[model samples]
Target: MTAMEANTDEGVIDAHHHVWDLSVRDQEWITGPEVAPLRRDFLLADLKPEARASGVTATVLVQTIDIPEETPEFLAVAADSDLVAGVVGWTDLTSPDVTRALAALRERPGGEYLVGIRHQVQGESDPRWLVRPDVLRGLAAVAEAGLVYDLVVRPHQLAAAHEAARLLPRLTFVLDHAGKPPIASGELRPWADAVRLLASLPNTVCKLSGMVTEADRDRWSVEDLRPYADTVLDAFGPRRLMFGSDWPVCRLAATYAEVIDAARELTAALQPAERREVFTRTALRTYGMTFTGSQAPQEAPCA
Candidate 1:
């Protein structure tokens, strides 16, 4: 049966979402009139019920800033929550002591929930930032620690992401938001080609998240997102694609339930097993996540 025909009984693993508190640290990125809605604190407590009602039994809490203190604090939050199964936190990729820093993070309380590391490479001025020697060394150390690396890149920076993934064959590289395609303008040239190139790498995966924010936030339709979503589905197939909410962030364009519904509509053409891959299996493997709820699927080794 097609995904649309499948029962909604299947559990979901929201591979990407974030939580932050302004009282602890200012989210300097949350500025300007367009982002005013995000200036307030987004705590896990605010997300739990909404997530659970949407069939999300587990979620990967992603990093929002470059702060050294945020990851440990997120780990602590994960330790206390039933919903957060994994964390993709941040650290300075260029720091000379990256390996030691990773080790120290692993030793912290709730550290075992640390599944991956992400840097705001999209914010870097250098176009080829990921391939830089120091950054590459840090990525290698991340691989050595048996962790995945999440790529949060702009469309223009995808080539560098491709090269970085090519350079690190052993590391599992997850492309967040399908490289943030140009859905707002309906442009699909280099973005589609670049995503195809990155997906050609055996070590990479792509998230079916953040597309709503990338589109016309005020009036986006599933049709507006189909081209980019179809491109990634064709390139990476179901096994390499996973679902992510990009929540609070997705709130810029859609509510959590609306985003989930849109994803279901987009993938309605796929078979039931393929749907499960996007909604469940891929995240289970990609992050090596361990879920605590009764609906959680059995753990599987990372592919």
Candidate 2:
């Protein structure tokens, strides 16, 4: 079945998740003791059972590194798997040839799975990186190609994100992890205020992701994630809000089922249709994802 012909009324569409191989290329960011658990490769096969058990019918494979070669590799992964319907890959947003690069990516195998582009904006020392003139031009090109840009910046950089989103109303800015709010500190003032400014834009949407990792990994509870979840729900509303597992990384804090269950509890007060918007429709619409049947065999040998 294809996305157009598949049943959209049920089944969770996990809008964000990742798969990596240490042998393919070094995941340079998987450094330091804090992230040591993630040093090994996590392939699609490992995610299959978890997603299936969680009732996740499809997912968007997001870029974990800024390397350009990784995008085509991820596209190849998506091409082989039924679980990944779309990809949020990366390219040099500062390169003068970015538009041609995007077109070139589209021409590669499984390039059609590319649905969005993202940068690790949170890593940049410059808080105003998103608004840089060169970056803005690349973003415009992303918009021109009909793909959304995922903002993965820290709280201090949100003002720049708001400015960029404001300047390009044609581009749909998907705020990944709701700007990675400071959930661990239990402080919401600055993050709340800054996120609202971005939410005020009509072209903006947000993902209820990364919260588990942001909170105290060892001691977090669903209640601990409520306020942050509630803030995004109130700011973006159900129509604009989408659910993402942020898997593997989320493993640092909660299991896949725990994350899914927490999301369900956080939005329990919403009407059923509203919850559906959060778990399913918003992702399908925002990412422009589509599905086709036929599962791929896993690479890992049976245990």
Candidate 3:
């Protein structure tokens, strides 16, 4: 009844995973000895086998950088692959013409696959960056374009994220990595309160991803991850949450399959239907993904 992959017969949708080609572009963030292993290319071809083995029939390809070129590149990659059903690309949220920029991206190749937009807000020094006037306007534009906004921010930034979600009720804010709680420290204060605040809003959702890297990379266990997972599950509930592998980047702590296993174990207490919402339905609904000729959206929930 618990701790198994494919909780839903519809198959799993990795709501957050990334792909990059070093030859196409340099990942400037992939620096230092700790993350150096991620410097190589992690293409769809490389993900397909792993995803297939893990029962991931669909995935949302997310942006890795804030560069303009990366979105188009990701859209093109989604268009070419059957595994990637949606894309959460990056665009400037501080630009006055961010609406046009989003429109222009939608008109590009594979634009139909554009489900959301993201920015590396975690790198920003300001704790309230998400509530800035210029940024709020851009987030409005994303809502206008019918796309969700993925938040990649530090724990301290969750407060601004909370206000931003409150102000922009029209825009669906997908919190990546549960605001990256300090799992390694086993401290979940302000972080837990902030998450509860954001989850109070109906428009906000969370991704059950990236816990492995946030925890002790070498000695982490499902027990270490349980409380944080329980926090989001208690706050957002499974319906407002979805599963994501945070792959390649997750390689820093766990393999793609290992990440999936951890998520399954973390959610072992939920009823079958609720588990379905986390492992499949929420992602499909959140991203508005459809598989024209794929084996996704299978007939029933897991027995």
Candidate 4:
């Protein structure tokens, strides 16, 4: 489908997607032969086709590993792509020169595209992941840089995520993938309660993306992600919730168009104006993107 045909309405921005090249970088965390399918290079050109097919005119490239060098590399790449509006790259939050690293990254070739910072907190063994002095210092630095902090954590790590927010009340934290909820077993209370707790803090925002893969993977339907997505919506409302495709990663469960259609199907009750906020406005605000001079959203294609 063409751009206009792909979007039921215009101004949609897919807030999360990932791009990586194993040849140039080591995505060591992408272990096992089972994940080998995603080990190859995924550049902007590779993503645009799918983005176009789903009316995803804007996208945010998230970090896949804990590589300090990766953020600048992405900035350089995003500078050349119209489709990539911002990037959420990694930094050593515990490093002694964390502030310097943030400054240097902001000065890089594609630094203008840098909107947020992320650490692979989910990979950590510590349940109270964010309370570590080094990690807390790092989070403070992100707030100092005026960049959002993308929280990548599993359900077990959410309590720490909440503490991180409470500890640093001034920081803006964007929860990736609805706290990476467990949908395969249909367990919702703890995850939902934890999410509501996090959302209660006015400084936090949640992304309504990556749910399809978090569910039963191959067996997931749009309905499976509803509870988790709705919890985010009900807690944060349309203004704080943003849409993301979690592309390439999303490819594991569903195609780009399929994911967009599923989210739209679930959100059908919202009016066009409200839907526009979920797809565009909230993301632009949360990520500090300015699309003021960009092309306006096109009308849906004629049948």
List, residue by residue over 114-182, the lDDT tens digit for candidate 3: 889999999999999889899999999999999999999998999899999999999999999999999
Q: How do the residues 187-288 of candidate 1 rate in per-residue lDDT, one tens digit apiece? A: 999899999999999999999999999999999999999998999999999999999999899999999999988898889888777888898888878887
Clashing pairs in 4: 75-110
Candidate achieving higher TM-score, 2 or 4: 2
Against the reference, the lDDT scores of all candidates come to 0.88, 0.86, 0.86, 0.81
Better of 1 and 2 by lDDT: 1
Off by over 4 Å in 4: 1-9, 294-303
The per-residue C-alpha lDDT of model 4 at residue 129 equals: 72
Q: Ten residues in a row with the worst lDDT in model 1?
A: 1-10
- Worst 10-residue lDDT window for candidate 4 reads 1-10
TM-score of each: 0.93, 0.93, 0.94, 0.92
lDDT by residue (tens digit), candidate 2, 174-289 = 99988888888899989999999899999999999889999999999888888989999999999899889898899888899888888888888887778778887788888885
By lDDT, the better pick of 1 and 4 is 1
Q: Clashing pairs in model 1?
A: none
lDDT, candidate 4, 190-299, per-residue tens? 98889999998999998988898888877898788888777888998888888888888888788888888887876777767667778887787888875544465542
